[model samples]
Target: MQKKNQLLLVVLCLILFGTLNGFGQKNQKNNENTNLKTSPKLVVGIVVDQMRYDYLTRFWNHFDEGGFKRLVNEGFNCKNNHFNYAPTSTGPGHTSVYTGAAPATHGVIGNNWYDKEAGISVYCASDDRYTSVGTASEAGKMSPHRMNVTTITDELRLHTQMRGKTVAVALKDRGAVLPGGHTANAAYWFHGADEGDWITSTYYMQELPKWVNDFNASDAVEKYKKPWNTAKVINTYLESGSDNNTYEGLFETEKTPTFPHSTPNLLDKKKDFEIIKYTPYGNRITTDFALAAIEGEDLGKDEATDFLAISYSSTDYIGHKFGVNSKEVQDTYIQLDVDLQNLLNTLDRKVGKDEYTVFLTADHGAIDVPAYLSDQKIPAGYFVYDSIKPKFNAFLQYKFGTANVVKNFSNYQFFLDHKVIKNMDIEVAKVQETIANELLNYKGIDRVYTGHQMMQNNYTKGIPYILQNGYNQKRSGDVLVVLKPGVISYPRTGSTHGSPQIYDTHVPLLFYGKGIRKGSMVNRTEIPDIAPTIATLLGIAFPNGTTGEPIAEVLE
Candidate 1:
């Protein structure tokens, strides 16, 4: 009986040990599963138009902790980021950032390019195949049809099996449409003036969502009726030029370009809401709308990763009107810093402090006003298209026996009338060489490459490489010209971009949040690399036409 009782006790002890072991193993598996997630709940991409890399350093002291500084201190900062191609305009810039390819591969050669076959200027985002969804204006008749490859946003949607949602917003149509890609749930741009509404095209949806309608119905534009002024103490704006300067372009109603400009005062002249774009209030409205999107769309709410692409276009508008050194430009960056802080705060509250990933970059940087550079004893001058166009046509006429042989000289390239050249029985390659040779003699022209040269040889460095990355064989022109450094084809007052110069190519690139390393890199990185880096962070496929390799340092 005693032996039987001892055996029963031993059996009971064995059963208890087995139960405890099973429970411990289950807990260990649960913890390991939680640690294995490779993707964030959401990705936010912010592109500030016409923002130079110097702007970050110029405004560094004025920036608050949560905006640019937050991105720099706690995030990975790529200080040497630049655009790898020429003609770094908005369309190509944004497309390159998202497609991981230059204009050559992605096919957004310029904001507007002369279509050689079509014999007409083609806007990059326009598509007559679809109608406007929100308003009856031509602004909504835009899509991503011009882009030849998939964007990172498009890849995310596919990786998630269509469960991930992508929504893009901007003041300019191309800014929103290109980044949104072919499969975006919606892409909206604001139409200012008498009809101030956020609009989209039928390519995404047939009607504006109820939330978008509600936003439009509200007095969102009305709140910005106050006059524009500096965000901080005006005296502290030592980083910029005087408030009144001849280098800055004036509003139609005003003579002197100074501070505290009135958007409403200028509204009477145009009778359109377009005047607001010239002020910092444009960025504010954009931030407000972005916040609304986060709430309305319920982003970052579930397992499926979402994406929000927001482009701040007012910087470009203001930079075009007021030179990069003007007080107004300085004021705009200060205001933008605050808006970014608000955006980051909202992400923390809505998406959790570490649940989302955010990257801030620029479409392209702008050159200093050529006039200003001249005054400062720098080598700068204007490349007037008005004067150069007629001469170029005359040369073509003199050589080919007819001016009609050239369709147009657009995006610093000559779109030769191919049919006309074939009809005249002239060798097209000979025509390209003859025209390219003559362009070198023009005052501002630095060098010229024929279509044949662009197609045959691959360039590795200098201006030739930059231009090569921008050239598209089927879509580009016959003769491509590169203006000398500090030479621009724009008016004297405001600055412009679209050069291989450092001022035009260098722009800020920052990555922060979930799965990103906290560090800084000063090595050379191009804008096209952004898309692949994001792809790596999200553990997704690279863009279809990607020519850039991902920055391994950015990944965790």
Candidate 2:
């Protein structure tokens, strides 16, 4: 009886020991998979306006070691990165980047859209509730209220219980506001020649900080008035076409769009500060503001991870004034490379090398000059909606016996007068179809997707799929228009981009610094992958509306 009792005791002891050992192993595995021991001190997101993936390659030989080359050689390069949706404008692109969602979910269809409910046009970041906090201009009336979903910045703020700071700076309001997300500590944008200062809306703070006030007090804009010249020899710009092309727009101060133009010549008498943005010096001032924010805000000093979002808007302005393949555009990029190097050096000193993570990308890429394409015998041309809108209204008037049925036409979308249609007892779907069919008859228009069709299958494939991803029920138009590849709706000179083609979709994405692997990824990746990758690195939940999967290879 004693031996049997001892055997039972031994069995019970063994069982208990096995159970506790198993529990310990399980907890250890959980900790290893999650709860990463450390995160980067700061996350710097640099967005260059109108940057195409090819730019990095086209100007590869000219780039320095610390600028684009440092990010490409020492960092992870996403060679196949692209924007996933159509109508890739500044507002939608920036919102999509930080939200990890498309415009359909983020509610930023374009830079500007016709509001059916308000019966007027609405700016993407404009809000009447918020007034300017730093300046006494109408510029303060902008906020991120239009954003329908949370961004990665918002996720960081929530995870850290609002301890982590998020700040953004840009030359344009939308460029600054959209990427900072809703919970940013401050989002600053350039206020123009009159104020010549970095300004923020009341949505951020009741007043500007002392550092910002002092920075604004400095005559930064005036300092760049010396003159604009090429960083390299004029003949070395072989990648770009000859200067003085018809595709380039001349500045107010110059007779020809040539080299060595005076910066003061470009400044408006009343709004001389506006000329700063037209030159590459605008990017310099923007970089200075970002550096100031870093020091003034103590971005990387704390235990919690912070984010500094910077967007260089001069590229877009320069691209719009001069075609993609001009000496001016080439020179702007060359100068921009130096500016990037300067910012990186500042980060190295302030945040420490490898202490922060940096991701450089673009809001949207631009298409080549339409006139240049035509000169090359390519099937490219401009589609002027001004002419087509009047004709379409006449067609609708003839068919429905009514005039002014089209309320608005912009962003390749049509806004019909719903109130008038309802009052006249006209079938909304039929009218939409009629307009879509009429639009198909116009030149450079590839296809048209009516609202009803989008609702049917959610446009799950092909061009319609791209259109649907950009459409929002409350904000989008009744019909979506797709242009033929290489065609635009802008003037004969300069260039623009708002298409689903490779020219507008393909953009450069480079991830550098902490928790990132060094190498190149050839696999196709979209813009939405960025925010989730950052979240994964931080060991935090992805942004609330994230539809993108983290690139497992990028995380350490």
Candidate 3:
């Protein structure tokens, strides 16, 4: 009897130990599940339009401690970030940054491209199916339907079952629309009419929200119409070359391109509210609108992650009007630094300090004014599109014994009239090769690629690779043209970006906040990497047609 009792007690002890071990295992599993579900409250993608990579270093000393300086000291900075495709215009830049795909896959080749089917040029975001929601103007008929693939924001919304909110704000419509994706909660851009109101399209909603209406009624543009002057004294902007250069474009009101000018004349005479976009005040207005969006939508206040895309378009406008080496450009950067500081401060207070993620980059970087380069004795010249198009048409006609064979010559590419060519029984490939060979002989032309070659995926490395990434057979032109280094096809007065040169392709890229490390990486990264990096942090699948790899250095 004693032996039996001892054995029974041992069996009960073993049973109790097994139960405790099972409970521990279940607890551990639950903790692992919780860890996998964790994510930041908000993700902010800031695109400073036309920002060059050197701007951070160029303006480092002038930057405030809490603004650009803070980001550099406490965030992961990709010092050598670059755009991977050619035709680095606003539309393609914004679309590529969020889609993780190039223009070839995303179908936004440039700001505007000649549509063969429509037999006319088509704007990147223009959709005739939708009407304006906030204003009577056609500016509101914008949507992201042209984008072929899903964006990072779209993936986030899908992951959360449409619970996540995505909002975009900018001074330009394409800057806001492309990054907001198709299923965004709302996308807003400054309309600059009847006292400057924010507008949207029927693609997102049938009517403007009550908050937007109230904000528009506030007459925000009236506040920015003050006597404009430099942020710091004129001489302090030493790196900008000179203050009054003939290369800069003057405003409608000002005689010379100097500062301390007032905008009351702009509003008083022409009622030109559009003038404000050319100044730093445009950046301020965009920031205010973004803050309103965050508060109004209650973004980042819930468990699911939200996205807010802000593109400061005034920089591009200012850069275009005033050359990169002008006092106006320098002053604009200084003022933008303050605006950035205020924005980060607000984000810290609204969404807890480390609960949000932010990345600041640019749509594209601008080239130095060709005139400025000429003065510096650099071999730079303006390749006049007007002069080239007529010659290209004549050349095509000479080859095919028909007039109007070249339908369009824009965006450094030629569009052949395929319908006319077929009727004339002209082989498209032969015409493309002929144009390519002839275009190469043109002055300031570096190399030319035929549409047939691109369509067949027969391209060499380097610039050809970039052209291939930007080429969409249906949307792009029939013959691709690349200009020599430092050559621009736009106005000689200021600067523009479209080439695959280092200056146009290079841009600033910095990442901060949740899941980010306080370090810098010198790795070569491209615009498409931005989307995949965000997706990786959120533990979501990459955008559908993603061709970019995740920036591993930024991931936690």
Candidate 4:
């Protein structure tokens, strides 16, 4: 009996010892995790308007080591990244990035689409019901009310019970409003020239914050008046076409599309700050405002994460004015590269080097000048919608006995008048079919799909799939049109984007700073994947209408 008792005591001691040892290992693992941050203190989303993926490659040698190169080398690059929907324009592109859904779900079909109920074309961000808060002018009369769903920023705010704040800044109204989402603390846009100021709508606040007022009052914008010039010698711009070419559009008062052009000459007697949109100075001022917002808003100052959405709108205006292959366009990008370097350096000082995450992308990519492509034996041409619209209306009148049945036409979509069709005793589906068939017979028209087809069928690939992704049942037009490859509805000079083609859909997607994997991915990725990746990193719920899955390789 004494021997058995001694054996039982030894077994109990051994079991107790094993239990303590297991807990010791578990406690040590928990201690190590204290040093590993699950989320960054802040997130900076940079959307460069009209930036193409090829710009990173073509301007690589010209880029500074600290800017685009740093983001690509020290961070992760989605090389085959693209916007997943058709009609890749500014409003829809920005909406898709933050919403984690396509325009079909978000309800921003185009920058300006025909509003059948409103009986007029509606701008994506324009909301006349809201008053201007920061400016007396109508420039601030805009909000993100058109978006039908939540964004990643909105989800962040909800996850923290409104402890997380978001501030959005851009040169264009839609640029600021859409990315800021519905729950943002502030969304500001620059309205310049005579005023030389930033503005916001009443949707976020009743008045501009004191810091924004002080920043606007300062002479910061005066520094950018130093004439627009090339960052390097003119001869170094060999990647672009000739300095003087017919493909590029000229300034109002200028004759050539060359650089070193007077910034003042571009502006008239009113000294309208509007010309700034066409210059690299616009990007500099936008960065300045964004930095001000960071300090004024006290972003990244606490444990809760904050968000800053900065959109470089000048790049889009410049790309539209100078086309893709011009010395002016090349110089703007180089200057933009420098501005981005300054921004990153500031982030390091204001927010710790590893405390913030950055994602740089573009709203959309522009196509090369169609005329220029034609000269190179490329199969490209212009589809003049203005001239063709009148003739198409006449054709509709001949077939349907009334042109009034077509209520509106924009974004290559045809909106029919249901009331008029009902009065004419015509079936709406029949009208859609007739219009779709007629559009297909037109030159430069590749394919046309009726809204009925999109509602009844699920397209898995090709242009039909993209159009379906962009189609909204209540807001979209009855008939959707697709242009042939390399065809654009634009002037001979300059460039435009609003296509499912790779040139417009392809844009840069770079991830940097904390919680980002340092590598490059040649595998395909889409714009909608951005918000979900951000949601995954933040350990928060994805946007309410999210249709995209997070890229598994993008996070650390």
Candidate 5:
């Protein structure tokens, strides 16, 4: 009887130990798979603001091996990628790049849009409810609420249950806000003062992290106090047009268009800091801040995918001030190549080479200055804003018996006060048609279609050039105004985007590092397709409202 009882106790002990051992092994396997499923240790998204597709080759000779060369030689380069929408501004560019949806779907149509509901112009990143954490004004009160769709960064956070870190740094607020997505760990943008060091709102965190405070307090601005100067020889930049030309706009303190800028004291003044937006160093500062964020956040450290979005804002500034063809633009690219090399080197040291993924692309490209194009007899000319608006107003008065039919005209978008039309009992659709017809008569105007007409028309054959790209009904204007060939909307110093021309739409898309293929795709791909591609690469869910498919060549 004693032997039987002892045998029963031994059997029970054996079963309990076996059960516990099985559970432990299963848990260990789960933890291992969880680490594997977390995706790349780091995903770095580098967006060069206003970077043209051709510039990559144009400045290729000057690039260091580890920077742009590493991306081109080692990564999968999408040669013919482009933004597939009109009004390709900075805000929409960043939003689309990160979200993998165009302005039509993302809801960030322009940097500052005339909100039909509010009846007031709303900045893309502005949120009145959020107070600035770094600055006094609401300038820092920005968020991604306006962005309707999820970004790749948002997906990374979601997949990790918000354990992974995501940080976006740029010189511009919209550049930072849109790419950081709704649930970013932190988004920092330069405000251009010793005190204005990268500001953010409480939306991300209540207080600045200790690392960020230390970085800000370091007084890095003192480095630029030694007088701004060109990093390369002027003559070596033979690819660009002559400096100090009539086409190029003058810098604030520097009289000539050439470099060796001696305006360090200008740093103390707000107006001078505004000029910093036009120089290449603005991008350097942006890169510096990005590196700081990466180190401070300890991104990609644990079992969560991390993302760091860095946008080089100087290209847009240089494009605006010097035009696309100026030596300034050329030099900026050359300098940027070196800066990119440094950034990549830092990434190699910080985030192991095969462990992280990097994708580099542009927001939008810029047109050659209209003045330069006209000089070259290329038929390019500035849009006659003064002539067109008054004519439209006169036509409106004739049709509706009032001059206030058009409320605002900017970025080729004409917003009509529907309230006034309703009160006056005027036919809004008829008025829009009349304005469209009149606009078509102008020299620089090509074709004009009412928003209703574009929505209904499926016959793309011989459709207007501007309407060739995808257009979403919700974000576009009441009347889609198409500009004639070789016509730009910029009236000020230099060139502008927003046209459906190849110059504004064509941009580079290169993917390098872990899991990326080493080949090129010349087939034309839209910008919205980028998000879906990233989602597939990381095995994350597709962003809502995405109609794009991942590039089949790059995927495994």
Candidate 6:
């Protein structure tokens, strides 16, 4: 009886230990699943239009701890970043970022350019065959049909055989269409003449998705109408120049380009929302749409990787209108900091800390207003277009008599009527050289390189700094013109970008979250490197025709 009782106690002890062991294993399994669900498989790419490097430091105090500050403190900040090509406009900027290639390869030279093949100026993303799926007018018709190379987003979708979702959101059509790549699930951009509404092109869908349509119809624009005031006191914006400067572009409702603007009158107009493009609130609207997209699409939910390309376009619009040193510019950065903080917090809640990765960069930076430079006793001056236009025409008239040699010269590219040149039997090369030589002699002019020369000269040296940084053979001008220091192409109303100057080419690049090293890199980095870095992070192949290497400092 004693032996039997001892045996029974031993059996009971074994049973209790087994039950506890099973519960411990089950708890461990639950924790692992939770971690897997929270962390994203890949990345989110955020490109801010016309975001200069200095803006980060300029408005650092106003940034929230969770937003811009989190990115800076936690992420690998590329202190010296820039575009490698001339004409740092929206199309090339977006193309370069995703393709990991410059305009020379990606082929989006400018926003609107004269198509030598069609003998007419063409919009970069415009597709006449496809009408706007979300809006009534064809003006909203745009796609990535013109893009020549695959984007990082395209590669991710391809890796998953189109099962993974890829989405892009921006205020500008090209901003959405290009970065999302050709195979994106959808690319939505802002629409509406008076009240901005987000819309998508037929390239991705037959109609606005139910979620997007609902979001737009909700009338979110009313939230901004509460009040329009500067984020801080006007006098506090001492970093910026005088408010009533002559070079600043006029806002739709505000007179004299001064602060303390009221929006009641502007909002009364049919296209009042257009003004939002020039305000920091535009970034807020864009972020709101982006969050809706993440939730509606269920991005990063499954095992497959997803991609989200978001371009905040208001910075570009505001930079163009207010110049770099206006009170408006300062306010925009401060508000943007706050908006970024809100965005980061949302991402943290939705995606979880370190679960998703983000890369914040710029399409391009801005140049200081030439007038401001001139006031500072710098040898600054505006591009003498009026003076050069007549000279160019005269040179053309002499070369091709009785022919319209000049169709148009804008966006730093000269479009010659090739039909006229062919019929007149004019020497195109000689005519281009003559024009180039003439322009090179003008004030504030640097060296000029014909397109042929740029293509052929593999070892050209002593090239003007601007030309060296800005030139891309295929899509760039037939004759590349470089400006002397402090000289801008656009004469009036604030600053312009398109030169290879440090002010325009230099931009900030910060990569934080998941696998990025915590440190700064001063090594020269171009926008093209962004795509390859993302591709490496996801373990995907580099973009086809990529000339840039992955940024080594940030990668494993």
Which segments of candidate 2 are over 4 A away from where they belong? 1-35, 268-271, 423-426
lDDT of each: 0.91, 0.88, 0.88, 0.91, 0.78, 0.78
* Candidate 4: clashing pairs of residues: 193-272, 193-273
TM-score of candidate 1 on Cα atoms, chains taken together = 0.93
- Estimate TM-scores for all models: 0.93, 0.94, 0.93, 0.94, 0.90, 0.88
Q: Which stretches of candidate 4 lie above 4 Å from their native place?
A: 1-36
lDDT of 4 by residue, 1-556 (tens): 9999999999999999999999998988885565345588899999999999999999889999999999999999999998888779999999999999999899999999988898998899999889988778888888899999999999999999999999999999999999999999999999985787998999989988899999988988767766788889989989998988999888777778776777786565558888888899999999899988889999998988999999999999989988999888888889889988998998899988889999999999999999999999999998888767778889978997878888888898888989988988878899899889988888999999999998999998888888899999999999998898889998899999999988999999999998899999999998999999999888889999999989989897
Write one digit per residue (lDDT tens) for candidate 5, span 1-556: 9999999999999999999999999998997676466467888898999999999988888777877888899888899988877777898888888887766577888888777776778888998778888778666888888888888888878987888888999988888888999989888888864454778988888888888788778866446554556667777777888766788777565678776665565665543455566677777777777778778888767657788899899889878877888887887887788788888888788887677888899988888887778888888776778876677678777878987777776557777777887998868787778778888888888778776666666633333423534355665567777787678777646767876677888999999887688989899887888888888878788777675679878754
Show how many residue pairs clash in every candidate, following the order shown.
Answer: 2, 2, 0, 2, 0, 4
Model 5: lDDT of residue 252: 60
- lDDT tens digits, residue span 495-530, model 1: 889888888999999999998999998899999999
lDDT of 4 at 182: 96
Q: Residue 51 deviation, candidate 1, in Å? A: 0.3
